[model samples]
Target: MTDIPNIPFVDLASQQNRIRADIDKAMARVLDHGRYVMGPEVAELEAELSKFCGAKHSIGCSSGTDALAMVLMAKNLRAGQVIFCPSFTFVATAEVVAWLGAKVCFVDVEPDTFNMDPKALKAAIETAKANGEDLAGIIVVDLFGLPADYVSILKIAEENDLWLMSDAAQSFGARYHNAPIGTNGIATATSFFPAKPLGAYGDGGAMFTDDDELAEDLRSILFHGKGTSQYDNVRIGMTGRLDTMQAAVLLEKLKIFDSEIVERQKVADRYTSGLSDIVTCPHVPEGCQSVWAQYTTRLPQGLDRDALQAQLKDKGIPTAVYYAKPLHRQDAYKHNLIAGQTSDGVLPVTDALSLDVLSLPMHPYLSDDTQDYIIEHIRGAISDLS
Candidate 1:
């Protein structure tokens, strides 16, 4: 197909151009060091991340999935223990639990925010208690770069004696009540996956914690459970080390992370301003700051998502569905389903969200010219639907 004013879903190149020299220098320095695995770059990146998160420890790991698995193993939430998470989240949130033999109890999400609903979470806990099940922990995700209601979630965790872990994968650069997500949870995990707000060039992730002993326990798990020595294994663990090359790329990216976040917000503002009349714009709760990792919008009633996406594609405006299926309906996880008392046809919020929501091109360098054309085409499409 000829380029009909084509725009990429993520314009990494435009952002790269601004920091090309610095990025090259950082990589060249790593090449000269000759320490590819667990090199100085790894430690340097960890230190920088810890500083950014305002935490005492930031243990780097191979990927976001590994970062989550490391925390699940560190805490040792035993098998048969029920963990509450939103069914509307990415699979990794529930995958780690199933991998460790723990049961994931799917909770409904808030309609506006598309995050774990505190009310539904409380009801799930109550239902589990009523049925005589052991509840272990709650993993609240900062979905789409916006932190969930941490204050309420934390209060509930304390009351139930359940460990709280913040899955800040999308929300790593976001803020809640002027404080970062890592500081709120007992320990938080974030992904530097290439699409995240503060993403690296490749797979990398980190765990943030305040407790001294807890931090050490997690570090041990990431390095094969060695007790201060590579050969000394005291407990079961996994090989989850973040690559030195990935860390090198992230260290350079971190220098401008704050600026990138600012620009992302600007781009989000422009997107919503242009498209709100044609669709239901994303809701970033008051007192929360989203990194705008995805500028998603809901199609107004009576508009078909497929038709709109097809129209945009034809017009060179790319859009994507973050998820077309909620976790409960996924074939791989059907056997492990632990949804609370409800009809199979229900889970209204998660179900409707699966159909109506679609994400537009979003990144720091989405030029106004491109965005304008994209929004204009969308308005034309919605009008056509009307």
Candidate 2:
């Protein structure tokens, strides 16, 4: 058999090559200024982010985790309080809640969208109240770049008197009901990790909000809870500020983020057209647009996902699983409460998805031929296995 050439899971090099000159200039400017910590570039990047997302304020932070932690800190999330989050997502969504000494109530996700199910959220809230738990808020994750069902989730939050925070780490450039992702909830947090849709050269993140007071609280929390001056310690905080050099790189990347989102959609469309017959392609609800951070699909039932990934690997194609185990099933969260749980546990959809989800090579620079190759191999492997 002829060996297939290796394909990059994410073609960051191509993106960097295109913007290397601008990135270099941006970095050089930061170097010349010598204000690496909370420098002028950080503010400039925050302003651009606000302009891009239509949010009234954007605060740059050290990472997506910090962005979320800062918001919870600003909200004064306390011990014994419960925050509901989907089980079928990265750990960071629930990790921040746990960090605040609060309980994380695991919620099931919609199988098709891989986002939080509003019904599950409502049931969770009711169960928590019945159990005499202090229900605080909800953190909805935009898994794999598609925004959660915000219309329904927002209504749930309002009726329950719980605040909503969007974990847009994977869906920063996405839209929900024609509104940007960052504008949906009380505050939205997004990462600039190199693998994300709008990734930077290194770790960085931002928080977006329309509430003036909440915005001020976030700024204070990220800066060690400073009051009138740096010496004045008002509230407890952490070192969550985004570095100036990372902000500089992100500023350049933001210039072409929209265009890159368009390109990413093209790649996703091609993948769906080629592989939809064999696998369950991602579903973007009407009036919503995904950034295609990871072109994930659900593999056929009764098929071994690990075996399929190994087959692809042999052909020089790489694959990844977003979450192999739901948060409810993980060791650290085993004791955490799950929504709608009776004697038997719930979160059936979340459990099922953790076993079958597969992420393909996804990025804006994926060429048609490369995508077609991936599509053909995936289809062929599934056929042979069947």
Candidate 3:
């Protein structure tokens, strides 16, 4: 092994340096105004994001988890109502459902795209009905920045009369059949967790929708259920407002998001071309664009994933597994599932994905030189292991 440059999985500093002047000024303005909570920048960012994503309204919230929860809250979900979701994702996606006292009917995902499988979703819905459970809605995750099969999933939602929510926390800037992610569902939730394609300096999130009534309810729920005035409470809510400082940071980042998404595509293309022979690279369906959120790939069967990570680590290359454990397997959710909600037998696809997935260094700021270094070492490591 020779010298290898250390690569940060997400190069936030490089991104920050590109717009340091704009960021500094924006933060300074917020500090001078002294209105930290729900200040001008908050509304400004909401308007900017709403216009950019073609959503009639965008509401900024505390975090991606809060954003999803707020939408569910506005929908007035209750216990025993089943919300179907994929198990092959971050816990936040399904946890929000359980928190609202709704049963999370776990579904499998497509092996290629790693997004929710509409067939599995339909099966879950029917199973829920067969077991005499109430079908409330479906939350489709845009896993690893690729939008789920909205063409099929939307049809299912419509046929079943279920409220469809797109959890675009990773695929915020992605596209589905020429339309932005935010427009794909009745409501879309995204995160600004400093690692997302279009991230803020700290925690933040937003929900996008064209529904006038839903948007109003979300705003009210976001502000502790304030109606007419801040002091007047009309409904139960949480302190879910996106702070002014994070909003200011996101405003500047939003300007360059489109171009950065292009850069991300280039990086992913290069990685796929270089490593496809050795590993199972991510797949993007036709007419879809992924922001390449994590650049996750699967290990070949019989190759120990953790061993490969150790090999890469010795050479200063970093790797991660997005979700090593599926949500259904987690102790917190193991016993709480409703009957007939397991997608036929066990969620085999989700279970398999949890064991095989490995996220490589991915970010728009990842330079071609760094990519070459990472790819060379990965190829070498796989070859040696083979």
User: Could you give me the TM-score of model 3 versus the true structure?
Assistant: 0.97
Task: Give the TM-scores of the predictions, in the order they appear.
Answer: 0.97, 0.97, 0.97
Which tens-of-lDDT digit does each residue in 99-159 have in candidate 2? 8888888888998999999999988888888888888899999999998988899999999
Instruction: Rate residue 107 of model 3 by lDDT.
Output: 86
lDDT of each: 0.86, 0.90, 0.90
Q: RMSD of candidate 3 to the true fold?
A: 1.5
Q: Which is superior by lDDT, 1 or 2? A: 2
Clashes of each: 0, 0, 0
TM-score of 2: 0.97
Query: Measured by C-alpha RMSD in angstroms, how accurate is candidate 1?
Result: 1.5
lDDT of 3 by residue, 101-153 (tens): 88888889999999999888888788788888888888999999999999899
Give the distance in Å from residue 273's predicted Cα in candidate 3 to where it truly belongs: 0.6
Name the lDDT value of residue 64 in candidate 2. 97
